[model samples]
Target: MQRSRDGRCKCLSKVGLSWKGSVDEDVVELVQPLTGREQFFTASSCAGCIILLDGGINGFEVQKQNRCWLLVTHKLYVKDDVIVALKKANGGAVLKFEPLVLHVQRQQLQDAQILHSVAIDSAFRNSGIIVGKRGKTVLAVQSTHGLEVPLSHKGKLMVTEEYTDFLLKISKSKNGGKQEEN
Candidate 1:
């Protein structure tokens, strides 16, 4: 009754935030339908993307927060983009492809699970509900199609520029295949 059990309503927060900085342009079409529904509000989303970063192998994993993001783009990239980013790396450089991801906050746990089922059916196999302290319920939807390749090591190019270009093309093709479902 007090706005919500936690004195917070994600729906209202979404409304309060301006569209310009809150949601990615490419993701609007996919989340638009759910936005109008009473039980759901989009918390965040990304259509798909490729990222070029300078990172280190910290205890067998890439320290995402500590890495330097050389380049990031939601649209398909060109060969020149990768070439420029590689020149800036002082350590290891990794090229990664990230697939579509969306987080929908639901009014009820049941509603979150219902949306989760649909996400899984639509090939977002990694979709799951996130629950924690407070009454918030969120459904995280993600596709399993993602790739990461090491492009450099010790500030030296590990793979040829041609190979990196080929990787971008492959990642772009994956995005094309996923878009058809939405």
Candidate 2:
């Protein structure tokens, strides 16, 4: 899954997964699987783009925009042999790189520095993060009441005994469910 910045909001985008021995061209042919069409948009030699439409069959409509000239062509029935070979060459590059795209997008949003983020730890399923521009904090809200802590501190950091006591109370309440489960 990939999310791209669309104005103020983020949008999820989809890309095809290619098998082994597939060339750049073959991979391009798998873009959109509903239309049974393949298309390419190449802005430069190093950075060429392709779109696959609909379902399986190797034919493609390619657009090549190079430094010197622009070329466009449509071909039908790509050879299975070529696809197999390119698949081997390309290997798992797409899969490895695809997840990072989503990660980078999320990181960009987090790093924007406008707002802070609070991520709940997997162990504390009932807890969540609370963030704001001034400072971000994480709190556990239980049936009774709860407390929160600001994990980030600028300049110097300090921990007080009262805060530690409050944290212990929150921890006990969070663990109360587990005790009952056992």
Per-residue CA lDDT of model 1 for 1-182, tens digit only, reads 11455544344246422223466678777887886567777777777888888978564466568899998878765579889989999888888898887888778999998888898899889889999799888899998888888888868898987788788888877776432211
Write down the TM-score of every candidate. 0.84, 0.16
Badly placed stretches (over 4 Å) of model 1 are: 1-20, 177-182
Clashing pairs in 1: none
The number of the candidate with the highest lDDT is 1
- Native-structure RMSD, model 2: 24.6
For model 1, what is the C-alpha lDDT against the true structure? 0.77
After aligning candidate 2 to the native by TM-score, how far in Å is the CA of 100 from where it should be? 29
Give the total clashing residue pairs for model 2: 16
Worst 10 residues of 2 by lDDT: 93-102
Give one clash count per candidate, in the order shown. Answer: 0, 16
Backbone clash pairs in model 1 (N, Cα, C under 3 Å; residues 3+ apart or in different chains), count? 0
lDDT of 2 by residue, 1-182 (tens): 23335322221133223222122342233222311211111111101221111111123221222211111111221223223322332111110001000011122233322212221222323333344475433232112222233211221223443443344333344433221221
